[model samples]
Target: MSSVPLSFEQLGSYSPMDFLTPHYRQQLHASLQYLQRPAGTLLLHKGERSLAQYYLLSGKVAVDAGPARQTFEGGSPQAHMPLNGSQPNPATVKALTDVSLFAVEHQLLERLLGWSQEAAYQVSSLGGMVEEQADEDWLARLLGTPLFGRLAPSHLHALLARFDYVEVEAGQRVVSYGEPGEHFYVIKRGRASISLPSAYSEQPALTLGEGEFFGEEALISGAVRSASVTMLEAGELARLHREDFVELVRPTLIPQISRNELARLSQQGSRKYLLLDVRLALEYRLGHQPESLNLPVANLRTHADSLDRDTSYVVTPEGGIRSELAVHLLNQLGFDAYLLGEQPPLAA
Candidate 1:
């Protein structure tokens, strides 16, 4: 191991890191400390319990397990696998060269991986929850979205009772153009391609993966479906009937930020708020909110994860369907977002 320092971005080199959501990864990166250790160091001792996972980014490690000693080289294809992943390591490992290692505590990593959220998703009775083993944060993630953020907890819990799970196979068509939207679908797992055949699109214009949702435009606009959704991978899905969506939802999407409240939040020392202008390039180029970032609704899903979870975004211009859609999409996708409108600054 080299004695040089490492950066948090290097965490991407670690395997299984993709199991974490972008927001969760950001949290882990913030908590991780850079480390480098040298040869002859005991990376793991045989039969010792592991409280954390170890990753090697450089150098070689010799493992003493069974009757033989095997060597693992850093920078190899599988170098990112957790070293001694078993709770009680069955092998003793020694550094063979100057090594770069990062240890992530199991507790924090598992918690951030959404395991802790599972218990919260359980139902007291057998009839309510579709799967007790479902993603624990599934409903919480929806409620955390801007639409339901202000909803009474009881109401959101009730809404959770209405969800149903559906398994989809790769190449399945989840929805089609010109169809009356009957349900709103949220991707529970797997990937899907979204494209509009009527629009003369030659390829999928958009794609959604886990925690992403679709079929809302028709539900919200009372219009026929504009696009077709096809599964890119076999996965589970959760759907809410349109009537349930309208009656239990729609109303919760009223969290709005007045111009002054936003400005005040932007000035607060602890709060980080951004004024987002979701207008066309030409319109935004003409004039926009001071210090606002321009991320059009058409491009929001692609760029949404790039946003830091610690910040709140106020999306403008207020009341435009485009802005409202952008706000809902951002909030629904786990961002702290609100429709932007202006009121005079409050009296100081």
Candidate 2:
């Protein structure tokens, strides 16, 4: 028998094992097997029954499914057949270098899934190898996104773990206005449309493709969706539940405003409050806070005189650096200001 002992910490880097209770890790460890593959090997093919899920202990592999392509390079692990569903499109898995892998068969996994928490831990620890590889794939893609740029590494990993991949067909309504929001979605492939109701025709606010995200506001605020989002074509998406939204997305969004600060600000009447909407005139005309004064961020400096020095200005921009910068500009101008909100809003 091989005498190599697995390292749990190393595996945690690429898997959701870190999020699992300690008991589950022990369960996984008992049923896991370590594997080593030489270079130039085919791990699995598309449409093949997944007998076992494999995790890279050390090495690399490339996965291609039709137009969607992802490569799991060395130093990070990769997982095969982690999800239960129809077989994935036949994907050619090629080792870029000599690879070390840990595997757990579906039968053993089935037994582990039904086991007690302690047993689950043992199984999970063993399963950690596969989980880590899957995690690495997700992490690689997530870290490459601009939306996740502001996040710290730890926070980013947590968010990645919470997301589940989903696929939708063209013309499917992913989200509907007035429906309770459940998950926030990020487009991984294909395109989607953001639309809102209108008398003549539904206004398409935007068309987004790879790396775009939506439903954040709904997730944060727990409010009815404000717009309808439909898949423009068959596509893949990464979805984060509301619970994950609070844990992952919310912390990275606009910095937290203190309750004391909010209370103090609320005591001041509306006349003392200046709501600045910094979106385009057309967007402002489409919809906005009725009381807000439209002074698009671009024109704010030129029209500085439009703002009142006695009032506390509240800057709002489409969720991004624009609004944050607006606040900075107001501060530099000796005006008291805070960021209020943005358009095409994200969840609170």
Candidate 3:
């Protein structure tokens, strides 16, 4: 904490967030809050659930650990980490002066920190088949995804049972634009190229190597194929029919959140919920929610890969099934997604 000089203009300068890489810290920004509190406040209490990680950015605080009491001024090593990080705080902390602090949900901070550390060092093969990896690695990748991560092990096993296999040759078309999207394909071996067709030529836009997946756009959006995938090398793919995919995968992936609930979340700190408006650029420019990010639907699939997984996104269009479709697609890629919609309240 002493590394940064206290400055009102640079909140991050005094934050634990300063230690994290830019990419990792951006993911936590939505769930974190900055606060200024008056003196004489009990910043923390003994035996209270540790709901958040509190860092004393600029403050004087006293900690009572049983019979002993110690004072920690701002920038001291004793105040570097959250006080009483255990489930129930072991001691009480009281503010001795007006203080500035940063707080983030304890569980969220831990999860993102773990993921960031893991992802930072992870190395994977671009050519190894999905099923060829060690069981732990292969399964973890499946469970790490947004759509399948929450599924029970038993459900995942059952879902895998429904897939059938096929081998494709180099230059073979897996799916074509303007055709009905009837199946989702998970690559088992080799690589493929994804192209979007316009006029007389198909422009190659992405490459899908082994262990990656494709063909989700049609199923999630219920639209004709938006692009085509052709094998770049002889490959094997596991295919799941649209009906089976809908029955097994869609229900658990998409969420319908009410306006009031979204409002309540927004007021919590204005950092947790991002109301994403995925309409055309022109439509979004006309009118949209305050603070919403404008990403048109056509580009959503491409840009979704870059979004921070730690933040919760409420994807919306001019309210209808369109919003649901957008959220559903986001969920497939492991995004924390929810849709803004209306449904009658249940009787209490």
Candidate 4:
């Protein structure tokens, strides 16, 4: 077998695929695995599960199901789509002749397609305003983000509609430390600075630019803002009201489990769950769940990349807000995370 990069021309005739935006079509080139197989090679067996979508590229293939069989030629209408679209593939597929094919992860393709459709609708909904065209880069960035990518198209569209655009001048305070969280903000045109209070360790401040978001930490936790966010320069922001955020975004992104449910999970030997306590090191030293890992909420984003996405994480409840915030951040970063509801006594 061999591998080859997919070109736009090669995918132009495929259904649904043709609907994807040019940018996403290009992005698919890197994710698709191209392969070559000799005649009579069995590519897929009946009743087997497949996580990828396979497309015939350059030869004929035979699809057999029970006593019926069909021959599909490359470039033909039948071959333009995936060899098998159902789970536990109902048919067996084999090469009728030396063949070349490409496969893309099912979930990844679905996400790109959803993003493309949603973005197209968003731009067209604005009547193709010049400003919308100009902000296409930021829009694409927002859509490609893990959090946004996972949202259903309908929910994403609703969230987009609820956002109110606002302008800020340099040095304007967008969110102040100790203030109740009200709205979630996404930078649309310029930059903002994040400053922690002096009482906290002097960690350097953070700067956020277009396509990046803030206020989620406070929103998820339902706590006072831990840091102040100020405009570094004149810029535009897309703000979602607290109510809209809680209703549309929060429930979709963060999954939750009760302490009793967690105990039930622990009883099952088939799956192992990781417990993460997002409290301060001192707090953790004093008391934490047995065998739980600790990584404070303040430092979560910085070290989030090092986490193992394959491991399911249950954020341990301390103040409840911190655990919720940690789970929100984990989900936003594409980790399999669940917030543990109800705080249990920490082990001494």
TM-score of each: 0.49, 0.38, 0.56, 0.67
Candidate 3 residues lying further than 4 Å off, grouped into runs, are: 1-138, 147-154, 199-204, 270-274, 277-296, 299-312, 317-319, 328-336, 343-348
Off by over 4 Å in 2: 1-147, 199-205, 256-348
lDDT of 3 at 199: 56
User: Whole-model lDDT, candidate 1?
Assistant: 0.69
Cα lDDT, all candidates: 0.69, 0.59, 0.67, 0.78
Could you tell me how far off, in angstroms, the CA of residue 223 lies in candidate 4 after the best superposition? Answer: 2.1
Give the C-alpha miss distance for residue 232 in model 1, angstroms. Answer: 5.4
Cα lDDT of model 3 overall? 0.67
lDDT of 2 by residue, 283-326 (tens): 77877765677777767666778778767677655534566656
Best-fitting candidate, scored by lDDT: 4
lDDT, residue 60, model 4: 89
Greater lDDT among 1 and 4 belongs to: 4
For residues 56-143, what per-residue lDDT tens digits would candidate 3 score against the true structure?
A: 7787988897999998877676666677666677789898988877777665555545544544233232223443344234334544
- lDDT order of candidates, top first: 4, 1, 3, 2
Residue pairs whose backbone atoms clash in candidate 4? none
lDDT of 1 by residue, 1-348 (tens): 454544556666676666665655666676553356678877777876664677777889898987998888877876878876667777888889878877665645765555223324434421433455446445435433445445554555677688888989999999999999999998877889988775465544788877677887777767789789999999988899999998887666645767665654444223467878787877777766667777887888768669887777888663277777777777777676777666332211
- Taking all chains together, the TM-score of candidate 3 against the true structure is 0.56
